[model samples]
Target: MAFVILKDLAYQYPSSTGLVLENISLQIQEGEFVSIIGPNGAGKSTLCYALAGFVPHFFKGEISGEVEVDGRKSSESTLDEWALNVGLAFQNPFNQISGAKYTVFEEIAFGLENIGVPRDEMKKRVEDAMSLTGISDLADRSPYSLSGGQQQRVALTSILVMRPRLLVLDEPTSQMDPVGTREVFGVVRKMAEEGMTVVMVEHKVEWIANFADRVIALKDGQILIEGKPNEVLTSDLLIENGFGISRYTSAAREARKRGLWKKEKLPVTLDEAVEGFKS
Candidate 1:
């Protein structure tokens, strides 16, 4: 069985007339990195909430079907219990900052302190996570005083310190620049390689194409396509449906039509495009 499984999952908010997520079913293997992409209001964030056990547990909504992670069902577990094995980072880092902490180190250590992790162990974990995200220098700074990208890194570090089995990220690098984005993606890729299952909602097609093990495209609260990143990120269907795609894919498509590109598959990353164009 897969490490993460969602079977016929559907959810609706109290104020909404229709389901926010419908007929969603997916299986993710242990240590796999899956990326979700779609336009606004596609329910991508809602799906992340469901995976992290906040859909019904915290959102107070109608949720049907199963969300099982490592044999424990979200429906059966309390939010606190489910949170131990799943960590979620929001798109906006400000939403994650805890005002109670005076320093970034304390902010990142809050989760560990909550579960009564030993003081020494918590410090070590927080320090390790900070270093991994390249935020060790910001350890003493106030969380509120940092820039958007810096805060995003701190938020991600906070989640990383928990060492969750599954990590759910909703545009975690949205506030970062190119260098920061690459660093964050590298850290996430490393985490997946080290046996963490990851589900990320992001619009950075090139990075997703280069790093994610699989791609799932959502539209209007339903999955429109699912496949390898090379196929999904370059699919014409994505363009037809108004879904975001890699710019290299777009350029390669146009070049192909002009008989300037002869590749059987379109490129989704800069390197692929350069190689194909040079051929």
Candidate 2:
């Protein structure tokens, strides 16, 4: 079943004179992990908000066409109702922290509390979420006192505990070191493996190649290309349009140009690059 559907969607912010998204349309089936990649200002974040019911609801912008997630249309669904079905975690984790919560544990629990989850169940959910994100040790600390990467993990855990049917992440690890990045990505990938749907906007092509079931390349607020991860990531069109390619993909492309790469298809990860060259 399609968990997310967008048809001919376009948007312009209240104060903006131009369209931020142009005729965007796509459908994400339940349990699919879709990765969106584009340079800054490509409207990736705006699309994330649309999926989470913030574009027309919270932003009060000019939105044309339709956006439906989990069978609820964004044009009509209330933000509160959408929140129960779609969770959004954006890049700047600090912006996501609720100023009302004092401790990290309390902050992660804030969402559950608002939805009237029982105290005992909420406690168990929060603890399990923290453990999944590897933040169990920091649960007692003040969320504000944590580093940017730590706070990002906390924000992710908050969304995870809610168990939204669809999770939209916009560069959720933009501030993290490699290890932290991998840990967070692993947690979300596992969520998808367990039947949750995900749409993530990220610049890290390598990670996307490894875990994303599909990759969507956005440029100038439009979807330039989208398909299976390897196909979209290794496309010459993607490279020409200034979308960042994996380092391995770039190297393989170069080797092909120099008649050193034997494979017809380029590699998008270190392992694939090594194996392709070995053949």
Candidate 3:
């Protein structure tokens, strides 16, 4: 079933004269891990805001066409109402953290409490969320005192505590180091494995190309190409759209130049590239 749907969607800011998104149409199914990649201003974030009900509600914009989450129209819903179903994690983790005085556990439980989940249920949910994000050890620490990676994890746990059906991550690992980036991606993959639909906007093609079930490339506020990671990452269309091929894919291409790998299918990961070498 389609968990989120967009049809001819476009958004125009009040102050700007042009559309941020132009004629976008796509459907994301339940429990799919998809990545949206593009240059800086390719409407990637605009699409995220539109699907999360932030464009028309929070930003002063003119919206056309239709956006639906689980068959519910986005225009008919408020940000607060939609937030229960869609969890958004921004690129800057520090901007999302609130209540600096609260311990990590309290921060995670705060949203659940506001939604009127019972006390016992809230406790279980908080614990489960922290565990899933690997932040159970930091539950008693203050958000300000934790490392940048830990803070990001806490922010993620807060969202996970809400038990959202769709998780929208906007460069959630953009600010992290190599280790932290792996940590954030690990958590994201685990959530997807557990049946949560994940739509991420990321610039790190190498990492996402290996894990994302589907990859969509955008250019100048429009989708340029989309398909399985191997297919989309290897296409000339992606290069034309300003998306770099994954390192492994590039290596495979280089190997093909040397006649080491005769296979026509491109590799999307280092493991696949190594396997190609063996073949």
Candidate 4:
């Protein structure tokens, strides 16, 4: 059985006229790294909320269909219990901050403390997660004093320390620079390889192509396309739907049109572009 499952899922926010997410059905295997790409209002964030058990739990909206993880349905599980196996990091780092913690280390360990994790083990987990995201040096610094990118890293580290079975990240790297974005993607990829199921909503198509096992493009509260990274990232349907794609893919598409590129498949990454152009 798939580790995560969503069947005919649709959700409408409180007092909202229409569904924010419509007719969404997906299955993710254990240890799979899936990336979701769409423009603003594509329901990507809402999808993350559903997977994290916040849709009908905290949002208290009309929802239909099933959200299942590890054979347990979200409808049958309490938010507290669902949160044990699923972790969600919001798009805005400030929204994720607890505001009660003074230092970054404490912010990352707050969840563990709330859950009654042993002090010695909590410290180790916090340290390890901070190191993983290259934030060990910022442990003593105030989260409020850090830059947007740094705060984002801290938010991600906080969730990582909990070691949730399913990790749902909404634009986790939006505030990061190119190098930082690469590092974050690398960390998530490594986690997925180590048996963590990850579903990330991101606009960085190049990184998604390089790291994600699959890509799903959503539009108008529904999935428009989903497949291997290369296929989905280079699909013309994405361009037609106003979805962002990799520059390499855009260039390769133009090159193909001009008869300068002979490859049937377009490039989605720099390495692929270089090789395609060379051949």
Candidate 5:
């Protein structure tokens, strides 16, 4: 059975007249890592919200059709209840930080404390999550004292400590430097390997190619393409629609026209580009 099922899902914000999403249907199996790619205003962020149960519940929007996660219908469950099954981490980690907390550790534990988790278990969960995200050393640092990347790690650790079955990420590494971006993506990949489902919306085509099990491209709130990472990321439709692809893919496409690249399929990463050109 699919862990996340969205059938004919449509949503429009309270302030907006038109739907942000329309007839969006998809099924994500347990432990799958799905990456969503789209141009600006294509409703990628909105789709992440729907997966995280913030669409109709938290956003108070007009929603139609079904959104079910781990067999629980989003409309049928309260926001509080949905939190146990889905976690959301977005682009602005600074906004996610609770200024009331004195230290990073406290901030990470805030969610668990509010949900009435036992103290002993809460501490253990936070420790594990920090370690998983490679932020254990920053536990005692002030949340405001950290750099943008470190703060993003803390934001993600805060959500991860909840042990939600499904994690929804919308450009979680957008603010991070290259090193920090890799560190955060490492944690995300590890979580999927350990059986947590993840839906990530990212513009980093190379990272998506490396980690995502499947890729879905969205256009105007509807699915434009859905398939293996290699297929969707390198498809001509994305290029025509003004979606960004890997630099390697772009260069390879140009080279192919000049009869410089003999490969039938374009490469999405540097390694593939080198091999494709050599062969």
Candidate 6:
């Protein structure tokens, strides 16, 4: 069954702007790892909010059409109810964390606790979340004391404790260094492997290309293309639509220009490029 569904979704802010999303339609199955990639203002984040039921609930926007999560309409649901099924992690980790007084364990437990999870189960979930994210060693430390990557992991663990059916991450690794990026992606990959539905809005094409089951490219608030990672990542349509191509694909194109590689099929990863050269 489709876990999340959007049919002709449209949203417009109350202030002075036009529709941020227009006639958008999508369906995400349970345990699918999907990534939405586009340039700024392509309505990627807006779509995320729309799917999470934050568009009209928190943003005071005019929304039309239907958005259903597990067969419940998003427009009629409360944010609290939506939180139980969809966990969202924003671009900025600082905004997601609570006050300085909350320790890492307390912070992770806060969500499950609010939902009235039993104390023993809450504790187990918190410990499991921390362990899965590799933050169990820092459970006693203050959230403020951790490094950027560590803090991001804490934020992720907090959401993981909720055990939502769907996870929506908006550029979770945008601010981190290379090591931090890898750490967070590792957590995401682990979650995906464990059968959690993940829908992320990210510009890091190179990292997500190998892991994503499907890629959706948005341009001017519309889906420009959607397909497997290799097909979508190597398309000239993505580049023409202003969605950045993978570095390896660009490198392969350059090699073709220099007469070093002449395969008809474009390579999306370095390994594929190497194989193409060998063939």
Which candidate should be chosen as best, given lDDT against the real structure?
A: 4
Comparing 1 and 2 on TM-score, the stronger one? 1
TM-scores, all models, native as reference: 0.99, 0.98, 0.91, 0.99, 0.97, 0.94
Candidate 5 lDDT, 1-279, residue by residue in tens: 999999999999999889899999999999999999999999999998898888988899799999999888999999999988899997788878989999999999999999999999999999998998888999999999998888988999999998889999989888888877777778888889999999998999998998889999999989999999999999999999989999999999999999999999999977899999999
lDDT of 4 by residue, 1-279 (tens): 999999999999998899899999999999999999999999999999999999999999999999999999999999999999999999999999999999999999999999999999999999999999999999999999999999999999999999999999999999999999999999999999999999999999999999999999999999999999999999999999999988899988899889989999999999999999999
Question: What's the lDDT for residue 21 in model 5?
Answer: 99
Local error of candidate 3 at residue 8 (angstroms): 0.6
lDDT of 3 by residue, 1-279 (tens): 598899999899888789989989999998899999888888888888887788888996899989888989988888899998998876677878876446999988878878899999899989998887778999889888888777877777888788789998888777668777777777888788988999999878778866788998888888888998878878878766667677777777788889977888887777778788888
Spell out the clash pairs found in candidate 3: none
lDDT of 1 by residue, 165-256 (tens): 99999999998999999999999999999999999999999999889999999999999999999999888889999988777888888888
* Greater-TM-score candidate between 1 and 3: 1
Candidate 1: count of backbone clashes, pairs at least 3 residues apart or interchain: 0
Candidate 2 lDDT over 19-49, as tens digits, reads 9999999999998999999888889999999
Judge candidate 6 at residue 87 and give its lDDT. 91
- lDDT score for candidate 5 against the true structure: 0.92
Give residue 231's error in model 2 in angstroms. 0.8
lDDT of candidates 1 onward, in order: 0.94, 0.91, 0.84, 0.97, 0.92, 0.84
Considering summed lDDT, which 10 consecutive residues are worst modelled in model 4? 244-253
Q: After best superposition, candidate 4 residue 9: deviation in angstroms? A: 0.3
* Model 5 regions more than 4 Å off: none
Candidate 5 total steric clashes: 0
Higher TM-score: candidate 3 or 6?
6
How many steric clashes between backbone atoms does each model show? 0, 0, 0, 0, 0, 0
